[model samples]
Target: MSTEKIPQIAFNPKKNKVLGVEIISIENLMSRNQKTDHSPEKAHVLKFNMIVLFTGGESEQLVDFVWHKVSKNTVIYLTRGQVNAFKFNKNLKGYLILFTNKYLEKQLNALPQTTTIRLLTSHLFSPKIEIPKDLFIKKYFHLFYKEFYKANETHIDTSTIHHLFVILFNKLERLKTNQLPQIKNTERFSIFLKFKELLESEYAKNRNADYYAKELHITYKHLNIICKEVVHATAKQFIDDFIILQAKRALINSTDRSSNIAYAMGFEEPTNFIKYFKKRTGYTPNAFKKIHS
Candidate 1:
């Protein structure tokens, strides 16, 4: 595969429209894709969060290279920095809601703490959430669709739209609770979130769990405990897994040479990075890239 960088779609809303939120029909998206240079079916990374609600037909979506089965009532969430590609079926019908992190931050600040926490933690797990069949709850999707389309009007009540999103998210949280392990220790979870934030910004420079622990102002043991409680992985294991994930994304998304990718990921030597990747993923960096590519 050539080393061309994957296409990255930034949040581009219409002029005078709210800077963060956009909702479009799947039909419109497909039409737009035909006119664009980038194909939705090809693997590319996103620069914003997206929620796609499939209201008809069935299909598969590639998120971070994992193909997930999706169908009616399946809502797929894609966060920023994740590699994804859409399999657009003629029968597929839904609405795609795109929101910027800045807009999400605004909503979170006004939302209930539980809503904020659930939304934040949702990114850590599976992106697909199967909404149960219920007419009343399903109406929330229509409400959001209706509310968002008003953006073209002279004045749109964004506050009302934001609240509708909060309600929609809370409903999804209820559905998710049925699928996930019970969350324990909010305080520990909070610390884990902080650790994640730091890791995202520093993983290219620091992979040591000890460094993260120190940055978070916690001992290594305490950090490990937090990691275990929240993600069922040791601190070191979590750090390594994150590094491997980033490596895989880079491998598939960039045209850079393996050595350059390794160096950019903070490895002192490309050989050590190759060995480390092989040990964790059972495939050398170039081999994995070839397979994924």
Candidate 2:
């Protein structure tokens, strides 16, 4: 058997639908797999944002190559560029809300500035939010489903859907904050967020902490202090972890060979890349690919 390269799934609105948002039941989505040709069981990199709320069933979902146990009230937030694959079981019942980054950004920009909104925009934190029988979440999802797919509507009222989406994110943000209290330091977190934005775009070209510090307009020591305060890792360690994660994602998600991946990731010599990977992960690139493949 051979593995397929993880696809880059883009957000394409359906016919006559102007809104970038779509909500569908898991059962309906799985049933259309054959016609749609995009099975949930396979891994793919997303080009948009997604929120999957599992209202029933027990299964594991793969996010960024790691499997997470999910059950009732488990909400998974998958942002753009993350690798995602769903384990669809017959008994699983849920709702998937898919939207474009542009749609989400526009709604976010219209909202007031707050820590919760900031956290929702920043992708530096965990993506899972487990709500234990929360009534508000249940009601919100129910209401959203009714409005999103209501019959007799000539066109979808995107404004209403956007408001529901904001409410959902705010609730998820509260839960995430409780799970990660260190993000409460608004000042440090703001700087750290900027650092992360820079790292995401420039990690392939530059892995040096000094470069990021210069881009953030802060001294190296100051950047390190902020990194430690927010994520409990030094600036350099954070950069290494991020790049290694990107490497791991590429290794498993793509069919590219180690040497090819090394060159794409800015390594001049594949041998040096192999050595660096081994030092950080205790496994050669080929070995890691074998284990994860």
Candidate 3:
């Protein structure tokens, strides 16, 4: 595969308007020749709700922060908003399931099991849960992969794909629960999740703790208390971190100049953004891009 051409697709619910889900076969993404360099690069960003499965090949597996030797029948899940990179060889095979968060939302409104999986959002962390090489889960994954191919070939209805996705997700949840004792949602963690949602929607216009506190229907002091307890940072600190993350993502992905990235990230002046970035990341936007690029 031309590692340079990372295949990507966006599932816009409005356009597709399907009742069920979609699945992309990862095997279809691999080049016919199969041997390719494994170095990390900006892989494609997939925007949709989905589960991703991977079977290791000859190349060392390198995905974001996680590294492991290629093994048979290995499976990995990539939910929405998670970015990934990988290297592979001839035997690599897997599937990428794309669905809507609405499917999960209809079942459970709050982000179920997100706290356990939140480390995935960072490029520098990996889960401790391991998939046994010869376990029954592998069989289920194979079944799901077969269904995925059938779905792609129009042999199965979208509803059948949706049902498979639900079953797979439930199994994954069970695996997670077994590996890590379910983290009880403390009042603090609950507030943090709400704060995070509000941050994503209003980060551009509002960065104040009091504003978030008012919107969350909690006192500023109480909000700060929750943030400090769960995130080990004050509310303002979390806001700064969120803004810095957005700045980094825009800078890395866009062809725009540093000044343009700053303005796009809601900074009134490029210089102010530069100053803020330097304070948090110890580098200017241009400098950071150079390092990552």
TM-score of each predicted structure versus truth: 0.86, 0.85, 0.68
Off by over 4 Å in 2: 1-3, 13-16, 109-123, 180-187, 214-219, 252-255, 290-293
lDDT of 3 by residue, 174-289 (tens): 65655432335566666777788888999988778899999999999998887766656789998997788777666656667889877777789999999999998889888876
Clashing pairs in 3: none
Report clash pairs, candidate 1: 3-255
lDDT of 1 by residue, 1-293 (tens): 65677888888865335558887878788888888888888888899989889888899998887899999988998878888888988999888888888888877765555555556655457889887786355578788878766655876677788888888766766666665545667788879999988998999899889999999899999999888878788999988988898899888878898999999999999999999999998999999888766
lDDT of each structure?
Answer: 0.82, 0.80, 0.61
- Tens digits of per-residue lDDT, candidate 2, 1-293, equal 23566678888755335577888888887797778666767777888888899988999888887788899899998888888888888889888888886677677754445534443444456678888684469778878888987898877777788899888867776677664645656888789878888898998799899999999889999999998887788999999888888898888778888899999998989998999899999999889877655
Q: If the candidates were sorted by their TM-score against the true structure, best first, what order would they fall in?
A: 1, 2, 3
lDDT against true structure, model 3: 0.61
Q: In candidate 1, what residue range of length 10 has the lowest lDDT sum?
A: 115-124
- Single out the weakest 10-residue window by summed lDDT for candidate 3: 119-128
Could you tell which candidate, 1 or 3, scores higher by TM-score? 1
Q: What is the alpha-carbon lDDT of model 1 when measured against the actual structure?
A: 0.82
